[model samples]
Structures are given as structure tokens and as C-alpha cells.
Target: MDKQIGYGRWKAPADVMARAMARMRERERAGGPRKAVIGSGKEALAEAIRRYPNDPLRQLAMFLDASPLPALIGRAREVSAKTRTNHGDMLRGAIGDLKAINMKVQRLDQLNRRQVMALAAYWTHEKGQTPGTVANKLSALRKFFTQVGRQDVVPKREALYEALAVTGVSQQMVTRQQVALDTKAWTPKGVVPLEVIEEVRETYPHEALLMELMLAWGLRVSEALGLRPHSSDTPNFLLVHRETKGGRWRKVPYMKDAQKAAYQRDVLNRCRQWAEKSRRLEMGYPKLTLQQARSRLYNVMAEIGVTLEQRGVVCHGLRHEFAGDMFFDITRHRPPSENGADSDWYKQNKTLVADAYQQVSEALGHWRREISSAYLGSPTKMSKAQRERMEQSMQLIAGNPDVKQGLVAAGVEQFWITGPAADGVLLRAGEAMQVAGRFQEGWTAENLKQVHEVLRAGVARPIQFVVSLEAQPQGETLEIFLDR
Candidate 1:
């Protein structure tokens, strides 16, 4: 017993510690040891518990005694470091609210779903947070709780929705109210007109150059500020390697037109000067935070007598203008319904438009082509010419004996084909054909069969078909039956 007690209290080997613990348990189970022996064993056990509390039982007891918010905050910090997000700030904000409310939530298990919902409600209604902001906060809290193994505190999705509804912040509710409230006509702001651009140039020369970089290259403000002349592989282009929002690198040329090459050269020299000045002043590279740049731009605009309504043109608006100009230059056709272009013109040029948008999207460092709308606006509706071409394509497909037989066998009664453009075709159930699918640009009979199977299986979205075509004319031929 004395040997075992000594092993327990001292910095002993692992085997010795194990033997000491086993013997102590055995002695206690058999009967109380002699008083002198028991006293020493109890002291050793206490010391062992303090030194190595790695047992599951000990951990449980510690968790039971731990305060909920601080433990969650600590766990959130660990998670944020791993994820490289701002989760710590979000968690701290919640804790700040809890402290303000004087809630006596001390234990990890003290927070129930109701309390969580109430807190979310407070942020939504009382704090007047947007539904999206509240949603993000709730999501962060859920992740934090899950990480800490306190998932019981996380509210159910339904319960959260209920809380949002009570606060009059449901997506549908907000969207409806917004639509009803937008009574007056409002043009999208930030499309810098030429006059406005000229005014900015004369007023703030340095800022105007930065604005021109964004306008011409579709560069983000951060991308412009992080530019280094050393990053240029050639005299006329620079490789952008900064951590973009899309997490990609792209090459930005100085200018497409040789006439503007001198201007581009001048801009590059000025950017180098700015970077050096920033380094000398120790004010940070590019010398401005995004907010500071925006504020300076706003001040310049104000000095030029641009109204709040006309102030829609910002750095991002310049990027949008770049995208729009690129689209027009590539397609040589405006979006359908814009500038009085008929549906036929749009349909004929759908592929060109899609290709142009995709090129712009890649240049802008965005992975999704759909995101182009934020800059380019919604795609124009299909033109009459496009409808006619689609109809012609469908007629050709129906004329193919194998394709027609397959369609009949698959119970497809009526269908209308839309495009084999840059994106793909939109095949909907027409007056006679009962099929719904979006076939790829080069779909075949097998692909059509797959679409038939998916529709039969009750897939709601348009089934994607992969078919091949041979030497179809740019906007006239519908030679889709030929395999690639």
C-alpha cells in the first residue's frame, strides 16, 4: 500500500501509475484499508486526479462546471482560426448581447432552444437586422455550439423560421414588402456616364486613374490596390495574384486598343509611385483600405456635383461597365429587348452573348457564370429569331426517324427546343411534346433517352442531355442528330 501510494503521488512511470491506481481501487473495493494506509491512498488519489484529469468522468464534471458563453467563444476562436473566417467577431457579438440582457446563462447546458430563438428574434426585430444578417449570425452560433459538443443549444430550423416569422423577417415577407414599397421608378446607380468620368478625372486625378483601371480591366478595388509593376510578365500586362474573393488568379492586360496603351503606361507608373509613397509613409501598401478608397471616391464625386441618385456609379459600377462593353463588343448585338433589337436578333446571338459573358466572368475572377448578372443585369428574353431557330431545330430532330421513334416510345407528346448556344438548350414541354430537359450543346439520342428517364423519375428541374451535332450553321442549321 505504501509503495502504491508513493507511485501515485510522485512522477512515476506509466506502468507504476497504472499499478498504483489498480491497487487503490482493489483495496477500496475489498474493504476499507487500515486507517493509516487509507489516508495515504486518498492523498495520492487526490494528487493523481489534479495532475492527470484525462478520464471521461473527470471531463464530464469539468464540462458541467464550465460557463457556456466563454467556452463557446473559446471554441469559436479555434474554429475561426481553422476556417479563416470572422466567426470570432460574430460569437463575441452574441456574447455582448447576452451580457447586455443580463441573462444568467452560466452552464453549458443552460441555453435551451427557446432562449436561442429569443436571442435571434431580438437581433431581427429589435436590432433591425436584415434577414440575411440574422441568418448568418444564427448559422455561426449553430456551428460554434456543434464544435463545442453542445448541439442541444442549437435551435431547430423550423424553430428559427418561426422566430423569424414572429419578427416579420421571413424571406417571402421581406421580398413582398420590398416590391410593394418600390413605387417610384429607380434606375440602377453607379453606371458612370462619360461626363461624370471626365469630371472625376479633372477633380481627382489619382482616384480617376484607379477608377479607369476598374472600368477598363474589370478589376476589383482590392485587386487594383494590390497591383505591383513587378508582377507584370510583359510591358503591357500584369499578373494579378492577390487573394481574390473568388480565390483565383487572373492576368489583366493594360488595354485592348493600342491607342490607349500610353494611358495604361501612365497608370502603371502612377500605381508604382503610390505604392512607394505608401511604403515610405508606412501607411500600408496602396495607401488605402477599401473603405478609405470608397470615401475618397465619394468625396470626389460630391465635389463634381454628382447627385446621390446619380452616385450609383462606384468602383464596382466601373467594373460592370467593362463587362457590358465587352459583351457588346463580342456579340455585336445588345441583349434582347434592349435598344429595340428584336427577339430574333437576340436568339441568333445567344451563343455569342453567353460566350462573351463567360469570358468576362473568368476575367473578373468569378467561377460562376450566373454571377455575371450582378454586373451585366438579367439576360434578355429569347428573341423571335431564337424561337424560330429552336422550332426549326425541334422540327429537324422530330424528322430524324430514330429520334422521333425514341420520343414516341418515351411518351414525349410535345416539346420545344430553345438553343444549342454557348450555355445549352432549354427544352420544355410544348403544346404537342411532353418533355422537359435542357440538353447540352452537343446532345445525342442517348442523351435524350437519359432526359426521358429523368423526367419519368419525377426530377423537377430540367434534365441535362448530352448530345452531339455536326457542323451546324452559326444560327441557321439544326443538324443535331449527327453524333460528335
Candidate 2:
């Protein structure tokens, strides 16, 4: 039996040492049992168990017992040297040019623990060694021991060389509200008033008109920059087809007087100048790089004493303004209702209003109603007076007998108007003549047939019609025929 103390200064009895040696020998013969080593520290244990499973105590005792200390020391020295070559080489090379300045591993071993710590401190503080560098060096040292054939001395671990990261104190995240256009976020504040538009027009006469267009239309800087003279020739409509931020192509329309004028003159001139000066391309082909135009616009605004913190308006703001104004107008002019139903023109002409929204969506290149509604904000309730007016309009359109006769004269095959007619009757029209084009045109046989189909379909808003002498010259009443 061998008498030896374990690594942690624990002494093993002679009998225990004998048993451990036997187990170590068994491990060597059969190889390490799967359970002997597991988890992170298992690898080194596995190797040791595999090498001397049956004689583990004898092997372990060699390190602990002074009688066998000389032999164990020699073995350790050999293993350490081998490890130094492989792991140490890799780590030394990783330091790159710094290797020349550092002591070799052999020298490192001669230094005391305090000396080693001081050296590490110097590398970090003086040389600015990054965490990654420390991690790499640690990995190399661990690898060296395992590779040097002294695997028994090394601990088995998966994350043995991983750096312990220092975490900073964290606080709760608080969201900040967005600042306005004229806020410090933007360079030029108050750049979008009418006066600024006038200044741009006067200063850059060639591009003056186009600046006005941008002020009126909520176009992107790039779209405005790309304006050409030919754009003015295409009626009052502006065709916008371009690739935006997410690399998606969109086609929308710009329909405003200011937009039309700006594109014709000022915008065209600048585009022409860019073509001639920068790209040396044909002046007839108008296009601007996305960055340059935005920069130019900001510079102009700055020169005009626009502050970044207030009133900075971008081309996109124009769209918001337009949508906001339109939404207000529609709500303001809405007629009233007679029934208890709170009168809202949108509610009254739900389908037609929906159609109008759809048209706007198409114009804005939006695929959803909710997205379009951003400009409308939340709907407001109407007053009783407004409701009464809506009811009157509904009744007038509902009870017009002239409409029914007209539908008949126009040869309407079949038509229907849901709910009660002007006289509080349901299914007002049996068959009516079609009304072609605008309601202003006189009804024809074709017109009467179309009107019949329209009524049958059940429109959102009631159609308006005036009584004709040929049909019936009397008090207005909605005339509708329901066929059994």
C-alpha cells in the first residue's frame, strides 16, 4: 500500500490507497467507464481513467507521496514540456508582433504568482489587450496542457478557457417622445412657411417653380429632384413611379396646381443642370442622385435661417397636410340625419365613402384601409342639426317618384333600393330607365335600364334626380315599382 495525500491536501489511508490503485489499474485495462467522467471536467478525468483505471490510487499516490515524488516530478516535467510546445506555441503566435516583447513560457514558469499577475495587468492596462485577446491566450494555455501528454494534471472542462465577462449595472429602459420637425433633431427649423417658399423661388429662379410644387405636394426629396419638363405636359396629373427605401417600387399620383407648376419650370432647370454638370448625360433625361438633392434642400433651408428645432417641413409633410385638410373638409361639410342615428356623411354613404377611401389608397399606393385612415384620425360624432339635414337628404332621394318614372322610361329591366323610399315604402323601383354619365344628363332607355340595375344593386348613398315634365309635374315623391 502507498501512503500519499490527494491534490487538495487530503490524506488517504493505506487501505484506501490500495483500493484506489486497484481501481486505477482496472480503468487502465478496461478503459475508463462512461460514468467516471462527465459534464465539463470529464475529459481530463476520462483520459486519466483510461490510462490507469485499475491503478488510479497508485498513480495518484505518486504525486502525494514523498517516497515516489522524484519519479512523479520527472513525469510531470516531461508532460509540461510537451504541453508547452503545442498550446504555448499556438498562444504565442496569436499575440502576433507582441511575442517578441514577452517572456517565453519557460521563463513564465520561473516567475512567482505575483509576478505573473503583474505581467497580465501590464498587458491589459499598458498594451490595451482586448477581452478577445485574453480569451485567445487562455484557450491556448489550456490546449497546451492537454496536448503535452500531462493531460492527467489538467482539469476536464468544456468552457475551461472562456473569459468571465463583466456585466455593467442596467436600468429600466424609458421611451422618449418624438420631437417636432422644428426641434433640434432637424438642422433647419421653420423652413416650411409661405415666406420660405417665396425665398426659394426668388433665389433659385431656375428651380423656383419646382420648390413651390414640393411645398404643395408631399413628395419625397428624390421624386421632386427627378422632376422633368415633360411632366408638365401630362395634364394636371403627376405620375410618381420610383424605388423607395425598402427597395420596393411604387406608383402614385400628384394632383395639385402648385405641384404642376413647380415640375414644369424650377425642378426641370435643376435636373437639367445636374445632368450637364455631374453626369455629363443628356439634359433631356432628368434624374438626381438621392443624397445630393436632400442635401441641397437642407442647405437652402439653412441659408434661409430655418431652425432645426421648429417648423422644419419635409416633402412627406405635404402629404400629411393634404390628407389632414381633406379629412377636415369632408367632416365639416357632412349633412345631418332625421332618424335617431347620429348623422355622419361617412356613415350615410358608407359604401361610397369606402370607395373614395379605396381610390385614395390606390393613389397613395397603400394596400390597406387602416393605413389610409392614418390621415383621417378618429371619427367624430355629429350634432342633432347635422343629423336632421342628412335625414332630409335621404328622404328626398328616397321618395323621388320622378326617379322611378325616369328609370321606367329608360327601360330599366330590374332595380331595387334597400330600406324605405321617400314615402316610407320599401323596394321603390320595379324597373327604371338607366341614367348615363353624370346625373345631369337626361335619362335614356339605356340610362333607365342601367339605373334599374344600380338600384337593384343597393348603393350606399341615394341618387339625386329632378322631376321632368314628361314623367310627372307634381310634388316630389320617390316612385319605385316592385314586381312580384
Candidate 3:
């Protein structure tokens, strides 16, 4: 039988209109029409009915099965590849968390703000996750939703903020408290003791040289493995030419002091012996990948009765120990005494301590002194006057035309004069802010001497300066322009 539909047009009698109205009413009752499901319902129904003209139930089922999470998760994997760390693991964990909450959500648009908060609470209490971890997971989910153009699914920051403020709620809901925990207890713990090193040496004799490099020079496992000796005029010093994690080709000197030079020479000799031994045994050079090296080191450490996990330490602890030792050696200040009188030296030589940290940071292939704090504990705070003096010195050197001309002649386009030292000036250069050559800050005769020395040292680029005002008169005689 044919029925008269819109404008007296004859159409087959079917319950399509009734089914669509029922679906819309069900959605409206559930909460409200999902933005994706609103206009999509009619289109889906029409497409299904057109494809399966003889089946009415198939049309209804097809309209109800639409989901967006699976596609969004696929897109998330693509995004994770661009990150330095593995974000896929985090996403997988987030998915597991969603499943635990029994939201059974197929589409991102299905979950409301309240449901999201419930998941947060579940992670905080049932899963016993830290505030930072919870925040990070939520942030990852938020980023995913935003990328997939379903940002409305992400709970509002205000809602999360209010949830955190409520008392007697789940631990995860206390976001402010968790944030405080992150700030106060975010310090890295990596300081391997000497006894543990000895035990490791005994367990893995072949890796002794590598361990020594990490302890003495603070070399990462990769850096130590990639090292090859280079010929230099300074026989005592080992010329290490390697690409650091920061993507800079650095020429770091391994033997900077008499003690370090002696230790490094011994280690080099020992390495040669090990290579010769391996060749004799026909066991190829003891070359290892970074993971292999870390595994071997960890295995040896575990056998030595050292609980690295309990101590909150890792293979990098040797590097931390080196940084701490170097800081103390350079500053000649021990850890603060109970009465705090032992730190008086730090107050007296705040600039020197800062400079030492800067040097240590560079030695570790890092650009920032603040990072050194993780290894060598936090440095003593500097006074306003001390900071001003350092700034003044840098300005004095930068204001000198001769100094600027010297750098420009060396082909350096732009540079930052960090601070002044007794022997030279500390500076960072280029758009990357790499540590450039240290230029001497002194009297006219001394300054000219340093310029020649710097040029001889192959610093063909412009070098930043940090001179003192006391040397200004002598600097003026060098026909230098002193602007501003």
C-alpha cells in the first residue's frame, strides 16, 4: 500500500519517521542531543534505510553504534611520536583508567564533566596515584580531546578546581595539595656511594673503565660508549668529541685537574688493556649499546647489595656524585653545618659559587645551572648586591667597544656576557645559547693578551665579555669605544 506523504507525494508505508522520533526522544531523555549525534542521527538513518531498504531494525542499530574514541586514540599515537618521551604508554594507562571507572564510553562526547571528575577520583583513591600523575593523565586526555575537535568533552578547569577545593573528597580531588607536593618534593635523588662503585667494579671488571668515566667526568652511558680518543697538544687531557643530548658537537676535556688527569690516564690505560685482552680472547672489542650498558651496570649494582630503587637512585647517580664532588671542590665549601656557619664562605663568594655551578653545568653537557641543582643540591641564594656586581661586570665588558670589536672580528654575530671571572668571562652564544669561548676580563695588557690567546685557541667567532670597572682605565688606553 502507498501512503500520501509531504505535498501529496506517494511513498511506501514504513515506520522510519516513528523510529527516528523515538531515537531523538531517547537521546533527549538521556541528557541532551550530543553535538555529533544531533544532525548525524537523521543522516545515518537515511543512509542505513537506503542501503538496507527491506530491513527497519538494521537502520536503528547502525545509528546507535557511532563512536569517536577509537579514531581519536589512533590520532593520539601519531601525536606521541613527535614527543621526546614515550606518550603512548601514558595514553594506554589512561584508557585502562577509563575502563576501570566503568564509564563504558565508546564516544568521547558521551562522557560529561561529572564522569571525568569521577575518573580523576578513581585514579587518586582506588589507584593511589599522585597528584602530578593524575594531572598529567588528565592533561594528556585533554590534549587528545582538543586535537580531535571534541574539547567540550574535556572537563572545564573551573570544575576541576572546585572539585579539588572540596574537603573529605577523594585524594585525587585535592589537586592543590598534589601540586604543592610536586613543587616541594620534585628533587631528583641520584648519589651513588663509593662502596657501591667498588662492588660494581668487582662484579663487572670489563665495565670498570666506563664506570670510572661516569664517576669522574659525569659522562652518560651513551656518551661514554661513543667516546674515541683524539690527539691533542695537551697529552694529559682526553679530547672528547661527541654530540651531546642537546644536539651540540662539544669538545669536552676529560682531565681538567691534576687529580682528574691522573685518574683519567689510568682509566685510559685500563681500557687499552681490556681491549687487548678481548682481542686475545677473540671476543671483539667490548662495545655495548646504551641499553646493554645500563642493563649490565644495573645487574652488577643489584648483585652488590645496593637497593637502587629504595635509595631513589639509578645509573645516573654516578654523574650526580661527580657533580656534587666538583661543586664542593670548586667552591671549597662543605654541606652547610647544623649551625649554618659552614655556609658563610658561600655568602662571601656568591659569584664564585654561581660561576662554579655554571662551569659544572657546561661540563655535564647541560646549558642551565639550575639543572645542576638536581645533581649537586640547591646552591646558596645570592644577595641583591652580589647579583648587581655580577651584572655590572658583564655590562662593563659589553659596553667596551674593543671587547665587542674583538668578538665581531672573530665572526661571532651575537653573544651573551654571563659574568666575569678572575681569569676570563663566561658567556653563551648563538641562537641556541651554547657556552662560547671564555674571554679574559682584565687590564689593557691582560685583555690584549687574552684576545690573542682566544684567537689562537680557534675561537674564530665573536666572544662575549664581562670586564670589571677597575680595569676600565687600562682598557681605555687600548683605543676601545665605551658607549653608554
Candidate 4:
């Protein structure tokens, strides 16, 4: 965990890199998840309950605790500490609320449907939790029941929505726009306010380290704590924790420029000091073991009123801050989450936007490039008013040489608007076609089945990008079928 620090730039060591390679060879030989399937997480949960009795965090850390599983559902392993804490809190809160009203729920199976809806009602009415918050709490509780092999105990989301008088969010949460609309709680997708972090640091340094790691590397709470000595062995990139999502180890390179790179190295070096033998995120004496470290990390933050549940300033937002910063660093343009570029910016630079999306996706350790949409919004987040204006702009000057050059450069081309056609207008950017104002309503999905059926026909790849969200391209407002 120790690095030679004297003040100059830190370079990746040769012997350390060799040692890491050796470890990699050993790991590859060992294979992934060679351990037998064994019993379900329920078995581990029982053992946890026995050992920790009163500690709900430790109890869930048994097997249902990796940085994956029920939360992501087959995407990653582990129930995150934040998630574990929420599940515990939600379940206990619900049970206590039930008991207060003469209902009983001592065991997992005893949590009834009515009790679940009642809790939802109380959260919305009495406590005044937003639909998103209530929904997340219910989901966490449902995960507890699901992981225990007793999913039926809790009512479904439909019932919860009906009782709570709200709508269900997507399983794959598109939170970028939602965060923008949020009034009270804020997203750190852009700049993480330093003052808020300093306030946290003034209170708890240990917790600050975890938050700092997430800010620096865009790591999950579990991933941030799983930092190791070998994590920073590479010269260019730092190896993210091995036990990452889906057990896949990601190599996120050090920060791009010199100054930021030095700060990143500093963060990793300090974090590695906390890494211990066979324990994830071991800082000093008491902060040993994943559960202990994780619990302390979150518990302290909650105390400081910086948790997402608390709607505090510096919760899981640091990761989003990293995303926004990394995107700007790579693309030189702020992300939509940062309120940087509207859909038109993306429309003008599809290729550039795609490349930036790919890089940010890799930086965020996502195999699916589009998944970055969760953190960064889709390219076509142009508002109706914005689209109307762009549509009018395009209509006013469809054959302008400048627009033609810009659109063609991105492979999302707009044809000459000054052409006449039997149908609507004769167009020939990549392929010859007639686009009239009549069927523009057909451009629904991304021209990816969301748009006109005619344009989608006979083309494996979308030839045109739809710039307007409303597909109001009378002349040529499209040239953005996001192909990242």
C-alpha cells in the first residue's frame, strides 16, 4: 500500500507491474467463481443473523452482499452496503410502523401485502417521501424477501403504485433527466460542491476517503472500499477492484492531465494504505473487513446528513460528478447531465458525441456503451421548444452549405432542402429517398423503430439521426441515430 512519495510525479513501478502480471496469471489460471454454487444467499443470511444478531448491515453482508445481485439482478454480485443499509432500515421501519399499529412482522414471511402498502402510504402521506424514494425503499425490502427465497411476502410494484398514487420507474433507471427535475435532492452529475465535501471531511476523514475514491474513479461504494495495493500498480491506469460488478476487474486509467493525474494518484495511494490482506477497504485498526468498513463509511455519512436517503449534498453523487468531469475532460463538452449540450449539440456532432460516449462508457467501466445513459442522458434530450426552434431553423435554411457539411461529417446527413419531389422532397445524403412533412410523425423511436417504418426498412444501421425529440423535421431536423 506504500508508494515512494517525495513530491514529483509518481510513475508506475516496473517490479510492481511485473508482480501484478504474475498475480493476474495466477488469477486467470484459477478461473472465475470456481467455488461451487453452494447454497443460496439465504444460508449466508442466516449465519449472518446468528453472528451479528443486532447488526442488520452485517447480516445482509453474508452472501447477498457483494457489489451485485438483486439490486442489479444478474448484472453484478453483492448487495451494496448502501442498499443493505436501506433494506435494513426500510424493513425495520416498516416492521416498527406495523407493530405500532397492532400489526406484527417479526419474521420475513410475516411482512404482508397490506403491511407493505400501509408502509408505502405512511411514507408518502406522513413522512412525505417522493415516489422515487418510496419506490426504492419498497424495492429494497422486496429484495430482502426475494433473496430469502420468499418473494411473495411483499406486494408487487403495481399495488404499491396504486396505493401510493404514483407511477413505477424503469428497472433500468434513467436518472439523468429525473435528477434535473428534482426540486429538493440534487444530483452531483456535474460539479460536486467542494464546500459540502469539506464539511464532510471536517467531520469524518475515513468516510471522506471512500467519497473521494468514488469521486476520483466513479466507483460504487463497494468498489471504492475494495481498493488494493495492486490497484495503482499500472503506469497509465489503475486497476479497479477485482471483485467489481460481475467479478470483472476494470482498469480505469489515471486522470487525463498532469495535475488531475497527480491528485488521482494521491487518492489511490492514500486508499491503498487502507487495503489489507484478505480484507477489502481496511483502514487503520477498527475499519477492517468489508462490512465494518462499509457500515462505518455510510453510517458516518448519514450522521453528517450527506446520504442520498437524507437528500444531503454529497451522497452517491460523487460518482456522477466523476462522470460529468470525465465527459468534459474527454469531449471538451459538458454532459447533458451537467446541462452542457442540448440535443442539438449532439445532433451537430454525432461522431464526436459517439466517441465521447464510448470513452465515458469505458471510463465508467460499462461494457454496454449505452448504459452511460443512466449517468449521462441520451443524445436526443432536446426539448420540444428546442426541437421546434431547430426544426424552424432547419426549415428556414435546409440547403445551407454549412449545415450540410456539419451533418455529413457525423454520418447523420441532411439532404438539400431546395430539391423537388413527387412525394415530398427528393433527398440524397447517403441514400436517395423522399421525405415529406406528412409522415414525419412516423419518426418515433430513434429512427430505431421509434421513427418512421419506411426509413427503418431495408437498413440494418440507421442512415439518419433524428435531432428533434418530437420528430418535427419538416425539412431536415434529423441526422442523429446515436451509434455509439
Alpha-carbon runs more than 4 Å astray in model 1: 1-129, 138-198, 232-237, 242-249, 253-294, 306-312, 334-355, 380-484
Q: How close is candidate 4 to the true structure, as a TM-score?
A: 0.45
Q: Candidate order by lDDT, highest to lowest?
A: 4, 1, 3, 2
Model 3: runs farther than 4 Å from truth?
A: 1-86, 92-128, 135-205, 230-257, 269-290, 301-316, 335-355, 365-368, 379-484
Candidate that scores best on lDDT: 4
Model 2 lDDT tens row, 165-273: 1111011111111112111111122234456556766776434444444444444456555543232212334344332221222333443345444544454345445
Local accuracy of candidate 4 as per-residue lDDT tens digits, 1-484: 6554122233445666567667644543543222322223566666666777655445545534432344342222455667667666775676667766666543443456667666766666667667677667777666666655666665564544454443333332211233221111134322245555677778676667777777777877777666554434466776664446655555677766677788788877776665533343343334367667667777777787775444444556677677767777777776764446656667888888777777777676665567666666654542443345345434433434443333333334233221122112212224333332222333333433333343354233223333433334553323322212
Q: Among these predicted structures, which one has the highest TM-score?
A: 4
TM-score of model 1 (CA atoms): 0.41
- Give each model's whole-structure lDDT: 0.48, 0.38, 0.47, 0.54
Residue-pair clashes per candidate:
20, 72, 4, 16
TM-score list, all predictions? 0.41, 0.31, 0.40, 0.45
Clashes of 3: 4
The true-versus-predicted C-alpha distance at residue 353 of model 1, in Å, is 4.5
